[model samples]
Every structure is written in structure tokens, then in C-alpha cells.
Target: MSTREEILGAAQRRLNLDPTSSMADIAAAAGIGRATLHRHFSGREDLLTEIGARSLDRWEERLDAARVGDVCSSDDADRLRATLVTLLGQYLEDSDDFGFALTDQFVLAEPTLTARGEALAEREIELFAAAQAAGVLRDDVSPRWISQACYGLLVAARDALRAGDVPRRDLDTVVASFFLHGAAAPGKPL
Candidate 1:
């Protein structure tokens, strides 16, 4: 891999483990000198912006692969559920690649990242709204709430995996099921 790519990968892993890591810490983690790291990225914010952009690209690709937009607009419950499973599965499989963007405050605060993230989230909210209108999702809760809840679930899943509270193999299934069905047991009162 190229040095830039290597540094980005190493930095991402390091940040995932600790969001408060310094640029020097990232340089050390990347196995490069501070000067070399600076040559590639102007500073920590620059590196984080790059990572955040890449993360958004990955998420957009997954959304497209799952054909989420198409499924959301349809009135078919089966398709909606299936698409959600596919989307969640892909996200879980790619957790390591995009986890940092969701958790890193600096990345989220970047102007470019904020704009791109809000755009993506707007699409997601529309998707949920369509699903709600189609009877695939509950109508009581707002679509915006569902979108935000889904994001929260993903963050929770990442934390759970890091904490070893959820098995790696079951991460996708656990998250998909929880999002679709909630924590209630069958025939059990809420």
C-alpha cells in the first residue's frame, strides 16, 4: 500500500481505539516520523477530514448496493425488511472502515463532513418516511427519529463489538433484528 494509504489506515485504527489521540500519536501508530506524516496531511484535522470523506463514500456505496432508495419507496414490506438486512449486514462488515467517522468529534465538526453527513442523513430520513407511508415501518414515530435511531444503533453496535459484548459473527444479525423488532420478546409486555 502507498504510504498515504498506510498512514490513513493506521491512523483510523488508532483513532477508533482512542478519539483523543494526538497527531504525534497517529504518526507513531503509522510507523512514520512526524515530518513525513505532515508531508501527507497538513494536520490532524486534515487527516480526519480525508478519513471522514472516505467513510461517507463507503456508506453511500453500501446504500446503493442495498438499493435502499428503491426499496424504501416501494410498498412491499418484505423488500423493505430484506433491504434493511442487507444494508445493516454491509455496514457491520465495513464497521472498521467507517467507525471512526461516527465517533470522532473532530471529524463530525468539520464543515465538509457536516454538509456531506447531513445530505446523506436527509436521504435516509426520506427513505424512512417512504417506508412509514408504505406501512413497512411504524407511522407513530417520525421518520427523522427513525433515521437518528438507526445511527445510534450503529454506534451502539460498534461500542458493543469493541467491548466484546457481541460476537463478531452475530453483529449484523443482532443489529438488524434489534432495529426491526426492538428488544421486546414475543408475547411479552413492553
Candidate 2:
């Protein structure tokens, strides 16, 4: 990899572990001098924005690879859920910082990310609608609502992991449970 790519990769890794890390720390992790790190990225915000953009692109790619549209068209709710869970798991494992950054309310508020996020939300809603149509999801639930809930669950999972309040082993189960059963009382048909 190019020096720039190496630096960025190192920065991303460090950011994922600790978003508050300093440039010097990132430089050390990247095996570059502080001067070199500064030469590459002049400011923290600039570096952060670049990282965010790259991470967002990666996430967009993951979503695309999920074939959400095709899956939704099949009206396979379980498949849709599994697709999301798998994509999310990969995203978390590959780029935890990106996941965390995207989940951050303030970062997501940025215009670019916000626009992309909205578009993604629309796509997710479509998937949710298809699942509902398939009778896998509750017909009473709105797609928009379900999409929002999904986003919330994703963020919660990230935060829970970061906080060490939830074990990593339980991540999949937690996400699945939320998406499948929801918060409603048990034994009631959805």
C-alpha cells in the first residue's frame, strides 16, 4: 500500500479502537513519525472527515452487496433480516470505527452522510415493506418506523459493545431478537 493508504488504514484502526486517540498515537501505530502523519493529514477534523467518507463508502458498498432490492422483491423477511444481520456483522468486524462513526448522531448529521443515510433509509423501508407484504412482518408496522428501529438497534449494539456492557458473543442474538420479535409482549401474533 501507498504511504498515504497505510497511514489512513492505521488511523482507521486506531480510531475504531479509540476515537479519541491523538495523531501521535496514530503515527506510532502506523509506524510513521509524527511529522509524517502531520504531513499526510494536516488536521484532526480533516482526517476524521476523510475517514468518515471512506467508511461511508465502504458501508454503501456493503449495503449494495446485500442485494436488498432483489431480496425484498422475493418477499423473504427472514432472508432480509439475515442479510442485514450478516452485512452488519461484517461491517462491525471490518470497520468498527466506521460503524461507530456512522452511528454517531452528530457525525450522521453532516449533510453528505445525512443525505446518504436518508437514501439508505428509504431503501431499507422498501425492504421492510416487502417483508410485511410477505406476511413475515407485522402489517401494522410502518416501513419508516421499522427502518428507524433498525438503525437504533444497530447504534445500540455498537454502543453496547464499545461500553463492554454486552458481550460480543451476544451481538447477533441481540440484533436478531430485536428485528424479529421486537419489544412487544410475547405470545401475541404480529
* Best of the candidates, TM-score: 1
In terms of lDDT, model 1 sits at 0.83
Kindly give the stretch of ten consecutive residues in candidate 1 with the minimal lDDT sum: 91-100
Mind giving the per-residue lDDT tens digits that candidate 1 earns over 36-123? Answer: 9999999888988998998998888877777777777676877876776777787776665678788778888888889988988877
Whole-model lDDT values for every prediction: 0.83, 0.74
Off by over 4 Å in 1: none
TM-score of each: 0.92, 0.78
Clashing pairs in 2: none
Tens-place lDDT digits, model 2, residues 106-146: 56667876787677678767877887787767889688887
Name the candidate that leads on lDDT. Answer: 1
